[model samples]
Target: MARASPACWPAPACCNADFNEARLERYLVLAHAAGITPVVVLTKADQADPAPYVAAAQGLSQGMAVVALNAKSGDVAALAPWCRAGQTVVLLGSSGVGKSTLANSLSGGTLATGAVREDDAKGRHTTTARYLLPLPQGGWLIDTPGVRELQLTDVADGIDVLFADLIDLAADCRFRDCKHSVEPGCAVQAAIKAGRVDARRLDSWRKLTSEEVTNSQAMVAAKTRAAGKFTKKSAAKRRPN
Candidate 1:
């Protein structure tokens, strides 16, 4: 789950303000949940100044590695640390973010790359499937198709760890289950008012937390139904029919 270098590639002409920060946060949470060291890699650095994007990505987590590089160039030495022997890295980003091109650069293989639309910068699905390739550096690379959406299920610990600062603040609240919304003595709300915490981040935390709970419950219900069906079939078989 280690987020290898290059999580995003800015648009060629200008910085894509439309880049989904929430989606990127979800990816980071997923990596943390899987116990992988997440690194944010900003690709297409040669086209524009990557300082802003780098800062934004770095702000996602304290001390998280953020690297900006021209993936089209064969020199990816900055990523060598994570691409070392015995390690495996995967590229996860939206379509047309140059995941395939980076994979080709890392593996020295000619992976099919698609051109982005001039009007929208959206890319076609050149890579329709996931492929595990051997990098010349002796590590492994998993190149996957662009992800439209990432669903979370049973990842409560990951969400808590990702939002550890908020979690810590919540511990000091008067009520153990304080929702932080209009709840008296809510430490989180106090921090937000004092400008210590970004209100948007708190919103992101609540969204992910609620989504995980809903999805986890759905998964449990599905599993229970499946088990009941299997049990009924076994009982019917035992009836000697």
Candidate 2:
């Protein structure tokens, strides 16, 4: 039961379209859903200047903890505060972001590492399964396979918490159901135009909100169908000769 999860991302020498802000925000939402405080760990800092990557990550949330380091250097002491005794940390990121390497550094385990493609910066799935290893500081680390896609379901509360600022701003809109698009007295839109909020962030919030609603409805429908099938099967068994 880890209370903290470090979401890893590689600080590439050049811009990597694969690892974008939207993807990172999704990870944050997932972490919040799981009641875990996420630490944004930007790996491969030695390959490039980590300042830009660090700043980008920090900008996603207020007072977010971000660490940039060379995971292979075996000097991940900056993460020790979260890896203290009795605590557990899970490594989460896409393939080739140095999750395995970071796991090795923290837990002293020889987890296999892989190389990323020069073209896209994506890597092979080196860690095929999830593992829970003990850290040197008496804590535990859960290393999971790199996730290719993260779908939002049953995380409405988490999303609300992550985007609290936007939620608050939306409350000021003239209409209770204002879509914030071409609506009169739309606080969100006003903020975007006034330079109070980043338009991209507003877009991200909308996308995540829509996705969460759709996925939640689908899940409920699936469960209702499953329950109906089970009830019918029970009725059939009771009516047997």
The best candidate by lDDT is 2
Off by over 4 Å in 1: 1-15
The 10-residue segment of model 1 with minimum total lDDT is: 6-15
* Residue 209 C-alpha lDDT in model 2: 92
Q: Residue by residue across 82-186, what tens digits does model 2's lDDT show?
A: 887767788888888888888999889999998999887888899999998988887778888988888999998879877888999999999999999999999
The global C-alpha lDDT for each of the candidates, from Candidate 1 onward, is 0.79, 0.81
TM-score of 1: 0.90
All candidates: TM-score:
0.90, 0.92
Model 2 poorest 10 in a row by lDDT: 6-15
* Model 2 alpha-carbon miss at residue 235, Å: 1.2
